[model samples]
Target: MPYSEPNSATLTPTAIFGGMFNPPHFGHLHPLQDALNLLSLNKLALMPCHIPPHKVTPEVSTEHRLAMLALLCAEDRRFCIEDIEIRSNKTSYTVETLKQLKKRTQSPLWLFMGTDSFNSLRSWHQWQSLIQLCNIFVLKRGREALLHFPEISEYMDCSAKKPLNEAQLLSLHTQTGKVVALETKLLNVSSTQIRNEIRTRNESEAKISEALLPESVLNYIHKHHLYES
Candidate 1:
């Protein structure tokens, strides 16, 4: 099915992809694009957090991260940027975002996350309440069993079958508090790698091309003298 921008005309399933996006790159973009296409979502919101609760605080300011994110969204109408966390001026939590979203929209809510994040869900603030707010769609490249995590075994839909595939996910009904493990091809790049490369390489070195970071983002980084420190 072809992609469509989100509209209120229909109560189609919508998704949210939240991250620090310190410097949004292919690793972040690829999985989201794949999800949007595979699931035939109404639209996906690209949220930038003010401060991530689990990882080290991002070195760049929220403004710069949002700016780079804006450049990325400019190319695709399917992805929209939401800076709620950045504007909140506090620690970012998944439950809080979902709560706000729940109050505003009646469409089914889907949260896109990687296996790493899904693994550490218990450690997040009010993690248990997460599944209550939206259905979780975890992205994994391998056929990893979702029930392996003892911490969240209770939340897993064991009877649904193992290693849920693309077809199952596409046809599966969206239920609140249910967990779905999805296999997808994701880029193996990280913001750390991108930052290290930019800091080590000179402008003449075209090693980090549009493949790692969007051309517009690369130019924006250079123009703003980001990651120099």
Candidate 2:
């Protein structure tokens, strides 16, 4: 079924950044901060899924992951934690989540995603429904042009021309079913790497003071003894 949002006189520009967030770190935060600044968005939701469809099971428990995200929310006023997917306790499908958001609010929805995920979007369950429900912002890390994966070019706003101006890019939010590329610097880090580092590190020096992770999140991890196995 095609999901359509009701017309509203007032709308808020909101974006959603969803992931396992097994442990939210700087890699997730940097790109999000850039999006918040570039869009001047009112609110950006940080959603953590209970069971990510594409990735392996998370190393930490759902409670631990949400606690870590809460720690982050405490530090930044612009970000908030959305736990619907966690509460579902089922496969986290993007389309279903966006539908729920539309039902909750009339905000113009923008879904932020990395190039790798965008490229493989066709594999997702009900992938086509995703764009119809909300706009997609592909956060490109490098200077290379956005990947023109098969069947995806139709969704890109090719008429707008390359290197879109500020106003042109912002206009995308006014409508749905368009995929636009946004250039931003993303930290070259991954949750898997962080987990490995913690698992292999010397037991006595288990404290990870690395700048890739926030101090509050680190404290929470150490307190819960997460990823030590």
Candidate 3:
């Protein structure tokens, strides 16, 4: 099935949160909600890459990841599950995916990512081109100092001070080829830690908290016995 395109007239300034989503958890959802509110996005797309370029292949299959993401999206209407990467069935690269999305929609595009991932932007395939294709929103994580890459830093717009106004955010979407570091509280949860917890700890001891995942997703993990190996 072809990925359905949104009505450009109805939804403008769409933001995309793409990742492995190995097991969709609260850690992923919380920051996304923050981005939606901060950026004042019309719609935020939860995209799961078919094959991550920087990390090892996810332990769970794409089918399982997609289903978990679907469950996450079910909680809110604003969230959209985008399967463009999965549908392509190729090593997912941000630039190519953005290109495909750009071609389909006239609405402005914003790509959401973590500070850690943003630090390694230089390593991505055609990383420079990716920024030109859409606005980049970097969510700060940890106390790690923000590392600047000359290629992208020159275009970074640090003028977006704390307590961003609607006008500033609107300007970001309308304009292209700039990076903005969003100011929002972020959670410390990680997929690797969650997977290790499930693999090493017994169910009673593991007790996956609602803070880490939705109950529905936890139930699905237990039912499927994911990451038991």
Best candidate per lDDT, number?
3
lDDT of each model, Cα atoms only?
0.71, 0.74, 0.75
Each prediction's TM-score against the native?
0.82, 0.84, 0.86
lDDT value for model 3: 0.75
The TM-score obtained by model 3 is 0.86
User: How much is the lDDT of residue 71 in candidate 1?
Assistant: 88
Q: After superposition, how far is residue 176 of candidate 1 from its true place, in Å?
A: 0.8
lDDT of 1 at 191: 82
**Residue 55 of model 3: what lDDT?**
86
Model 1 lDDT tens row, 63-97: 89989999888767888887778778678888998
Each candidate's number of clashing pairs is 0, 0, 0
- 1 or 2: which has the higher TM-score? 2
Clashes in model 2: which pairs? Answer: none
Tens-digit lDDT track for model 2 on 114-138?
8888878888899877777777877
TM-score of model 1 (CA atoms): 0.82
Could you list the CA RMSD of all candidates, in the order they appear?
Answer: 6.0, 4.0, 5.1
**Model 3 lDDT tens row, 1-229:** 1122345334477679998887888888776676666665647899998877778998788888888889988777789898899998788989999999988878777888888888888888998888777778887654545677655533343322344576665556456666777655667788887788887876564675455888888778878989878
